[model samples]
Target chain A: MTAREEILSRIRGALGDTPSRPDVPRTHRQQGVHRPGTPELVRQLIDRLEDYRATVVRVAAEDDDAIGQAIADALTVRGIGQVVAPPGVPRAWTGRLADVVVDEASIDARTLDRIPAVVTGSVVAIAETGTIVLDGATVCGRRAITLVPDTHVCVVRAMHVVQTVPEGLQRVDPRRALTFVSGPSATSDIELDRVEGVHGPRTLIVVVAG
Target chain B: MSTFLGMPGVPVRGPAADTAVGHLTGDRPFPAAARDSLADTQLRRNLAHATSTIRAKRAAVVTEVPDWEALRDAGSAIKADTMARLPELLEQLEANVVARGGTVHWARDAAEANRIVTDLVRATGADEVVKVKSMATQEIGLNEALEAVGVTAHETDLAELIVQLGHDRPSHILVPAIHRGRAEIREIFALEMPGVDPSLTDEPAVLAAAARTHLRQVFLRARVAVSGANFGVAETGTLTVVESEGNGRMCLTLPETLITVMGIEKVVPSWRDLEVFLQLLPRSSTGERMNPYTSTWTGVTPGDGPQEFHLVLLDNGRTRALADDLGRTALHCIRCSACLNVCPVYERTGGHAYGSTYPGPIGAILTPLLTGLTGGDDPNDSLPYASTLCGACYDVCPVKINIPEILVQLRAEHTEAHADRHRLPTAEAAAMKAVAWSMADPARFARAGRAAALARHGIRRGKPLLPLPPPLNGWTASRDAPRPSAESFRDWWARTRGPSS
Candidate 1:
C-alpha cells in the first residue's frame, strides 16, 4: 500500500474503535461544542482584546448600518479616504459609507497600501476569549487584507460567535486556511517594549453585530 | 551540491570560556554580575513594561474560559507522559509514518540531523528549499549546513526572512526580528533584496510588500519544504504547525517534498492531548486564545499536497536531558515562549547574549545539557549562571518546568566539572575552615555575633564602606552594605526584660 494508506491504517489501529464517542457527527461534532452566548462572549473577547491593547467598539445587531458608518467614521478620524473590502462583503455595508471610496476584491499589497481601513465579516468569534476567527470567506479576505491595513474593522454576527476556544476550533475547517486574530499585530522584542503594527495591522477594531 | 551525509563535522563550542572568561573567577559565583544586572535602569523598565502587557493580555483571555486551568494541567500532564514513554511512542510514530509512504530518519545530534536533511534535499535535486520558521532547523544551523553544500535555504516567514537577510540571530522566540525596528528592516531590504523598490520607505506596508515580492518567487519554485512541529500526535503520527502567517500553508502544500525535523519532546499521546496544548500555547506565547493558523497533516495526501513526505525524529541529547531526574522537566517545554516573555535577563541582554539558537530560560537549561560543558572552552557552560533564579520563568511555564531549580542544579554541575580549576587557595580555605568551625557550634556563633555588634560601633558614621576586602568585594560592587546594629537583638532583649520575668 501507499504511504498515505499505511498512515490511515495506523491511525485506525491506534484509535481501535474506542467505546466513548462524541454526541454529534464527527465533522459537525468538532464545531458545535459548548461555547458562551454571542453577547457575553463578545463582551469578554473585547475586554481581553483591550488587555492586549486592541481598540474595540460595540455595536448592536439592529445597528448593522451603523457598523459600516462606524468604519467610515474611524477612517475619517484617522484622516484616510480609501477602504478595502472582500468580494463577498455585503454591498449594504459598503453602500452606507459615502465619503470613503470602498475598494473590493482586487486588494493587492499595492492597493492595500493606499487603503487606510478594511472592514470584513468574521467566520466565527470566540466570546469566551474575545477572539475573531477569519477564514478566507466573506468580509475576511485572504489573511493579507486584515494584515496589510493599518486598521481592521471585523463585523461579527451575534449568532456566529461562540463561547469557548474549543468550540471555535471545531467550527473552523482544517483543510482551508484560517486566521485567528486576538488583537492588532504586536511585538515586545525591542528592549521588551510593546510596539504595535510591526508587520501586521497596527490597529484592530471589532464591530459586534447583534 | 553536496549532501549532509558526505560533509565534514563542525565542532561545537561551550559558553564558559567562549566570552566570559575574564568576568568569572575560580569561585564559580555570579553574585557580582547578577547584582549589577538588577541595577540596570533601562533593562528594568523594558522588562517591566513588556512582561506586564503580555501578562495582562494573557490573564484576561485565559480567565475567560472555566476550563483554562484544566487545559493547562492536561497539557502539562500529556507532555510529562509523552516524555516518560518517548522510546515506545517514537517507535510507534515511526512505524505509522513509514506505513503512510513517508520516510522516517533518526538523528542522534545536530550534525547527524543536518546531514540527513541536506542529503534529502540533494537527493531531490533541489537547490533551494522554502522553510516555515522551524526552531529545530535553526537550532541545528541547517541553513548554514545547506549553504556549505551550495543549496540555498529560503525562510518564508516574514520575521525569519528579515532575520536571515540582516545576518542577525533571532532575539525573541515568537517574533525573531523583535530586536529590529522597521527603519532597520527597510535598510536591510534595500541592501539585500534583489528587486526591492528603490523608493521603499520604512513604512511597515512597504517593507512587507518588498518581502512578499522577494519570497513569492521562491514559494512558487522551491520543490522541498522543511518544517518543525509544534506537536507530533503519536496516535495518528500527525504533525502540527501553529502559525500566524499563511506562508506556512503555502510552504507545506506547494513543495513537492516535505521534510519535518521535530525534537523528540514534541510528541503528544493522542489527538485529544492537543486540546490542552492548543488552549495553553497561544494564550501564553502570543497572548491569543487560539493562533491564526494551526495545520495538521498525516503522512501524505494523494494529489492535494506534497507527493513525498519525511519525518526526521531528532534526539540530539534530549534523552540525556530526560535522564536527569531534576532536569527532565526541561524536555516538557512546548516552546510556547512564555518563559522568554517574562525573563528579566533575556529582556535586557537579548537573545544574542545567550549565543545559541535556543535562548532565554529554555536555552539556559537546554543548551548546556545538549552540548555539555566539556568541549574546548565551550560557551554553553556560562548559560547556567545567566539567570537570577527569580522564578518568573517557573510561574509562566505552561508545563511547570522548575527553571530556577534546573538552573541551580546545572550551576552545581558546572562547579563540579571545573572543581580543580576553581579550587580555593590554602589561606582562603583555612579562613573558611575556621568560619565553618565557629558556625557549627551555637556558643561560638553567639560569640561571633557579639563581636560583630562590637565591630559595628567602631564603623565611621558619615562614611559608609564602599568596597569590602577580597571575598566580599563581589557583594559590595552593586549594592550598599547594611549597617550592623550596635547591640545584638538577644542582648537587647535580655537587658530590657530581665530574663523573661
Candidate 2:
C-alpha cells in the first residue's frame, strides 16, 4: 500500500467507531467592534495604525487634487523622489510627485528593488487589527508591486474602512492573492522588541482619502 | 544531484520517527542539560526579558475580547472536529489541490518528506533556495538534508537567520535564538554572514537593517523556496502563512517555485474557520492584535506569485498520537509557543534540554507519546518527569490543552512501561510500594508512626546526621532534613480518645 493509504488507514483504525462530530458552537463575537455606526471605529483604525508606527493622514475632501497634494506632501517630507504607481489610480496623485516611475510593463524584482516607493489603492482596511488588504486588482497591482519596494503609501477611502476582520473579509476576492498588511514589515524575533522595516516596506503611509 | 536521503518515495517505519521530528537525544538528560543552561547568566537574562515581554503582550490583547473564552472553545472544538474527519478532509484536500494546478505528495515519515523536497529542488536545478521560518521544516531537519545533497537553504526570517548564522539549535519556538543577547547576535552576523556590514551595532533596528540588506539580495536571487503552512483550507486548497516579517512574503512570492510541507492536522474543514485561528494565533504567539502580513494563496495563480506549488502532507507520528484520546490533544497544538513562555520549568531549562525539535511544556509529554516510550532508556522517557505539574501551560494554552494532566498521565505510563525492563526493583517503585502498603492498615500505620518518632534520637543539634545513609542521604544531599516530632499527631489524639469513644 502507498503512504497515503497507510496513513489514512491508520487514522481510520485509530478512530474505531468514529462518533458523529459535535456541532461547532461558533458563538464568538464576529464583528470588529461592539457599537455600530460609531465614529470611534474609524478613530480606532487610525489609533491602531499609529500604534503600529504607520503614518496616517486623513483627507476629508473628495477632490482628486486634494488627495494628490496629501500624497505629495508625504513623499516630500520623506525625500522619496521616485515611486511606482499602478494603473487605475487617480493620475493627479502620481503626477504631483517627482520622478514618478509609472511603467506600462510589469515591474521585475530587480527594477522594483531600485524603486524607493509604491503607491496603490487597497480593497479594504480592518479597523480592529489595523490591517490593509490588497486584492491584486488593477488598482492594487500584483503582490510584487507592494512587497518589493522600501515604502508603501496606500490610499484608503473612508468608505473602504471596515470595523472588523469579518467585515473586511466580506469585500475580499479570494481568487486573487490576498496580502493583509497590519503595518510596515516588522520583527519581534530578536527578544520580542518591535523593529520595523525588514524586507517589505520600511515606511507605510496611509492617506485616508475620501 | 545526489539521492543520499534514501530512495525518493515512501520511507519504511524503522526509526520512522527520527525522520519526522529531528533528533531523539540531547547530549545529556534534562537535569544535566538544564544545569548548564541555568548557569549561563546571559541566557537567563535574555529568556527572562523576552518571555515576560511576550507574556504581558499576550495578556493585554487576550483581555480585549469579551468573547475570548468562547473563541478558545471554538478553536479547540474546530481542531477536534477536524481530527475526527482528518482522513476524509485530507482526501478532499488532495483532490482540490490537484484540481487547482497544484501537486500533492504524501510522506509517511520525515525521510520521505526531505527526499521529496530535495528532488523538487534538483528538478528545478536550483543550487540554493530561500526559506520561511517553519517549525515543520525544523522538525524534519530539512536544511541539513538539503545540504547533504549540496543545496543551500538561506533562512530569511530574522530569528531563523540568527540560528542559521550562529550555527545554533533553536532555543525557543517563535524566537528560535531567544537565548542570545544583541551583542551575541552582532558577533554571529559579523563572523558568519557574508558581506555583512562591518559596523553592526547591538541596537535592534541597526541589526535588523544589516540582516535585511543581506537577505533581500538572497530573496531576489533564489529560484526555489520552502515553507510550512499555518493553516490549509481543504475546501479550496488555500494555504495561509501568518508572519510578522515580509521574509515569508519574499519566499512565498519572489521564488519561481514554492514547496510547502505541512502536517496533516494543519488542515481546517473550511476557510471560515480561520476566523478562530487567525484571532487566536497572533494574540497567543506574539501578543499582537495581528501580525504584519497574512498571505493566502490557492494552488497556483497564473501571472502572480509562484507558478509551481507542491504540498507535501506529512504524518511521521501523528497517526500514533491520534490513536489515543488522552494523548492526541498534544496534536491540536498550533505551534503558538505560548505554553513554553509561561512554563516555569521551561523558563529555566530552555529548548535544547528537551532533546526534540519541539520542546517546553508540549514536548514533555509529546515526545514520549510519539515514540511510544518502548524502552526504559528511551531519551524522551526522562521528559515527562521534567515538569513540576504547574498548570500555567494549560491556563495560557489558547487551545486549552490540559498539559499538566497529560504530563501526569504520561508519567504513570512511563513508570509502568519501564518496570519490566528492570531486573531489580527500582528505588522509585520500591519507595512507592512501601508507602502504599504501610498506609493500607491502621495498626501498621501506628507502628510506622511510632518508629518515625523514635528516629528523632538520631538528630544532633536540631539537624539530621550530615551524611545519614542510603535513602536518608539522598534526601539530605541537596537539603537539610527536618527532625521528626517527639509525638506523632495520631499518638496525641489516640491517648485521649482510645477508651471513651
Candidate 3:
C-alpha cells in the first residue's frame, strides 16, 4: 500500500470498529451585545487597537477626501516620504501624499522592501480582538506589499468593523490568502517581555472612518 | 521509511519504535536529567520569572471572557469529534487541497517526512530556506536532515533565531530561549550573527531591531520556505499559522514554494472550528488578546503568496497514540503551552529535563503515549513519572486534557510492560506486596506497625527529612521523607479503647 493508504488504514484501525462521534457544543458567545457597526462597537474597536499600542485616528467625515487627508497627515507625522499603495486603493486616500507608489504585479518583494510604508484598505476588522483582516483583494493588494514594508497604515471603514472573531471569520473569503493583523508585529520571546515592532511593521496606524 | 509488519492489535515494536525518533527521547532518565538542570540557578530563576509572568497574563485575559469555561468545553468536544473521524476528514482535506491546486503527501513517520521536505527544497534549487517556528519540524530534526544534504535553513523567528545562532536547544515551547537572559542573547548575536552592530544593547526592542536587519535580506532572497500548521481546516483545505512576529508572514509569502509539515492530529473537521481555536490560542499562548499576525491560506492562490504549495501530513506515532482509548486526548493540544506555564514541576526543572520537543505536563504523557514504554531501560518511561500529578495542567488546558489522569495511567502501563519482561517482581512490587500482606491480617498489621515505629530513630535530630538506606534512597533523594511517628494509630486505638466499646 502507498503511504497515504497505510496512514488512512492506521487511522481507521486505531478508531476501532465503532468510533464515538461526540456532539460538539457551539454554545460559546457567537454574537456580541451590540451589532457590527454600531457606535459602541466602533468605540470598542478603537479601545482594543489602542491597547496594542496602535495609533487609531477617527476620521469624522466618511468621504474619500477626509480619509485621504488623514492618511497624509499620519504619514507626515511619522516622516514616511514614500509608500506602496495597492492599485485598487482610492486615489483620493493618497492624493495629498507626495510619493505614492501604486502596487502592481511587476513589483517584487525586494522593491516592496525598499518602500517605507504600505497603505491599504482592509476586508474586515474585529472589535473584540483588535484584528484587521486583509484578503488579497484589489484594495488589500498581495501579501508581500503590506509585509515587506517597515510600516502599515490600514484604512477601516466603520461598516467593516465587526463585534467578535466569529463575525470576522464569516466576512472573510476562505479561498483567498488572508492576513489577520492585530497590532504591530510583536514578540515576547526575550524574557517573555512583550516588545512590539518585529519583522512585519514597526508602526501600524489605523484610520477608522465613520 | 521502514514499513510496519505487525497486525492491528499487535504492539508496534522493533523498527516502528525508532520511526518516531528525533528530539523526543532523553539520553538519561527524567530524575537524572532534572538533577543537573536543578543545580543551574540561572535556569531556575529564568523559568520562575517567565512562567509566573505568562501565568498572570493568561489569567487576566481568561477572566475577561465571560464564557471561558464554555469555550474550553466546546474546544475539547470538537477535538474529540475530529479524532473519531480522522480518516474521513484527512481524505476530505486531501481532496480539497488537490482541488485548489495544492499537492498533499502523507508520511508514515519522521524519516519519510524529512526525505519529502529535503526533496522539495532540492527541486527548488535553493541551497537555503527561511523557516517559521514549528514544533513539528523540530521533532523531525528537519534542519539537521537538510544540512546533511548541504542546505542551510535560516530560522526567522526571534526566539528560534536565538536558538539557532547560539547552537542551543529550545527550552520553552513559545519562547525557546527562555533559559537565556537578554545579556546572553546580545552576546550570541554579536558573536554569531554576521554584520551585527557591535554596540548592540541587551534591551529587547534593540535586539529585535538587530534581528530584523539581519534577516531582511534572507527573507526577500529565499526561494523556499518551510512551516508548520497551527490548524488545518478539512472542509476547505485551509492551513492556518498563528504567530506574533511577521517572520511567519515573510516565510508564508515571499518564498516561491511553501512546504508545510503538519502532524495529522492538527486537522479540524471544518473551517468554522477556527473561531474557537483562534480565540483560545492567542490568549492561551503569549497571553495576548490576539497575536500580532495570523496567516491563513487555502492551497495555492494565483498571483498572491506562494503559487506552489505542498502539504505534508505526518503520522509520526499519532496512530499509536490514537489506538489507545484513554491516552488519545494528548493530541487535542493546540500547542498553546498554557499547561507549561501553570505546572510547578516544570517551573523547577525547566524544559531541558523533559528532553523532548514538547515539555511540561503535556510532554510527560504525550512522549510516553506516542512512543510506548519499551520494557527495559527506556527513557520515555521516565516521562510519566516526571509530574507531581498536580492537576494544574488540566485546569489551565484550553482543550481540557486530563494530563494528571493520563500520567497515572501511563505509570500503570510502565509497570505492566516491565513486569511482562522480567521474571522476578520489581522492588516497588515487592514493597507493595509486603504492605498488602501485612494489612490483610489485623494482628500482623499491628506487629508490623510497631516494628516500623523503630524507623523514627533514622531521623537526625532537628532535621525534618529522614534519609533512607540504599534500596529506598532513590525515592527520598528528590522527595522528603517525613519522620515516622513513635506510635501507630492502630496501636494507639487498641491500647486506649481495649474492650470498652
Candidate 4:
C-alpha cells in the first residue's frame, strides 16, 4: 500500500470504530474590537509596539504628507540614506530619501541585501500582542523585500490596527504569504537572554500614521 | 510489522524490534546517561540559570492574560479534536496544499522521509541548503542524512548554528546552546565561523552580530531552504513558523525551493484556530507577548517567496504513538518546551541526559510513545522513570498533556512489557504479588509483619537508604526506602488498647 493509505488506515485503526470528537470550547478572548483600528485600539497598539523597542510615531489619520515625513525622519535618524519601497507604498514617503529603489522583480536578492532599508505598508496590526501583519500585497510588497534588508520601516495606518489576534486574522488574506512582526528580529537563544536583531532587519521603525 | 489489536501501527507482543525505530531512542538508558551529565558542574550551572530565568519570564507574561486558563483549555481541546480526526484532516491538508501548486509526500517512517528530502535536495542540484530550526527535522536526523549524501545543511537559528558549529548536540529545545556559556559560544564562532573577526567577545549582542555576518551571505546564496511547521492550517493550506529571529523569514522568503518536513500531527483544522495557538505558543515558549517574527505561507507564492513548495508530511513513528488511547495526548505538544523549563529533573541533569532530540518531561513520555519500549535493554524503557512525578510539567503545559499521568501509565506498560518477555516476574512485581498474598488472611498478615520487624535489629528508622542488596537498591536509587518499625501497628494497638474483634 502507499504510505498515505497505510497511515490513514493506521489512524482509523488506532482511533477504533467509534472515536470521540470532543467539543472545542473557545471561551478565550477571541474578539476585543468589532471595528478595525479605532483610536483607542491605535493607542494600545503604539504602547505594545514601543514596549518591544520599536519606534512608533503617530500622524494625523489621513495626512499622507505627514506619513511620508515621519517615515523619512525615522530613516534619517538612523543615518539610513537609501531604502527600497514596494510598489503601492506612497511615493511621497520615499520622495525625501537620498536613494530610493522600487521593490520590483528586477531587484535581485544580492542587490536587495545591499540596500540598507525597506519601507512598506502593512495589512493589519494587532494591539494586544504587539504584532504587525504584512500580506504579500503590492502595498506590503513581496516577502523578500522586507526580509533581505537590514532595516525595516513599516507604515501601519491607524485604521489598520486591530485589538486582538483574531481581529488581525480577520484582516489578513490567508492565501497570500503573511509576515507578522511583533518587533525587530530577535533571539533569546543564548542563555535565554533577549537580544534584538539577528538575520532579519536589526531596526524596525513603525510609522503608525492616522 | 504485524498488527496488534487490529491497529496497523501497533506492534505485536514479544520483543517487537520494529518499534525500536528512529532517533527517538537514546544511546544509553536515561539513568546511566544522567550520571554523566550530573557530574558536569558547568552543565548543571547552565541548566539551572537558563531554566530559572525562563521560568520567571513565563510566569510574568502568563499572569497578564485574564483568560489564560480558558485559552489553555481551548488549546487542549483543539488538539484533541484534531487528533480524533487526524486522517481526515491530513487528507484535507494534502488536498488544499496540492490545489495551491504545492506538492505533498507521505513518509511511513524516518528512512523514507530522509530519502524523500535527500532526493528533493538533489533535484535542486544544490550542494547545501539553509535550514530553519525544526524539532521534526531533528527527530528524524535530517542533517546527518543529508551530510552522508554530500549535502551540507546550514542551521540558521543562532542556537542551532551554535550546536552545529560546536559539533555538539542541542541541550535545550528553545535554546539549543543553553548548556553553553557565552564564553564557549564566542570560542565556537571564532574558530568554526569562517571570516569571523579574531577579537569576538562573549557578549550576547556581539555573538549575535557575528552570527549575522557569518550567515548573511549564505542565506542570500542558498538555492533550497528546509523548515518545520509550527502549525499547518488545513482550511487554507497555510503553514506557520513562529520564530524570534528573521532566519525563518529568510529561508521561507529568499529560496527558490522551500521544503518543510512537518509531522502529520501538526495540521490543525482551520485558519482561525491559529488565533488560539499564536496566543498560547509565544507566551508559553519564549515568555514573550509575541515572538519577534511569525511567518505564514500557503503553498508556492508566485514572485513572493519560494515558487516551488513541498510539504513532506512525516509519520516517522507518530502513528505508533497514536495507537494507544491514553498515550495519544503526547502528540498534542506544540514543541513549546514550557514543560522543560519548569521540570526539576530537567533543570539538574540537562537535555543531553534524556538522549532524544526531545528532552525533559515531554521527551520522557513522547520518545517512548513514538518508539515502543522493548522490555530488555532498550534505553527508552528507562525514560518513563526519568521524572520525579512532579506535576510541574503538566501545570505549565500549554495544551495540558497530563505528563505525570502518562509517565505513571508508561511505567506500568514498561513492567508489562518486561513480564511478557520473561517467565519470572520483575522483582518489584514479585514483591507486590507477595505483599498481596500476605495481606489476604489475618493470621498470615501478622506473621508476615512480625517477620518484617526483624529488620529493626540491624537497620535504624532514620538511616540513609542505599547500599542495600541488588534488587532493593533499585528502589533506593531515587527513593528513601524506610526501615521496618520495631513494633508493628497491630502489636502496638493490641498493647495500647484491644485488637478489634
**Most accurate candidate by lDDT:** 3
In the range A120-171, model 2's lDDT, one tens digit per residue, is 8888888888989998777887788899989999988777777876667667
Q: In candidate 2, what are the lDDT values of residues B166-265, reduced to their tens digit? A: 8899878899998888999989988998998777888999999999889988988889999999998888788899998899999999888999999988
DockQ (C-alpha) of model 1?
0.09
lDDT of 1 by residue, B325-412 (tens): 5566787888878888778777766565676667789888977776666522456667898898999998878778889999999977
Between 1 and 4, whose lDDT is larger? 4
TM-score of 1: 0.71
State the displacement of the C-alpha of residue A160, model 1, in Å, after optimal TM-score superposition.
Answer: 8.3
Candidate 1 lDDT over A153-176, as tens digits, reads 778777777866667766775434
Q: Which regions of candidate 4 deviate over 4 angstroms?
A: A33-35, B1-22, B464-467, B476-481
- Which model, 1 or 2, shows the larger DockQ? 2
User: How many steric overlaps does candidate 1 have?
Assistant: 19
Name the lDDT value of residue B186 in candidate 2: 89
Tell me which residue pairs clash in candidate 3: none
List runs of model 1 lying over 4 Å from the truth: A1-162, A168-210, B1-53, B373-378, B420-435, B454-467, B489-501
Worst lDDT window (10 residues) for model 2 chain B?
A: B1-10
DockQ for every model comes to 0.09, 0.51, 0.65, 0.65
Q: List the residue pairs that clash in candidate 4.
A: A61-A210
Task: Residues B35-142, candidate 3: write the lDDT tens digits.
Answer: 999999988988899999999999999899888888999999999999989988999999999999999998888889999999999998999999999999998899
Error of 4 at B90 (Å): 0.9
lDDT of 3: 0.89
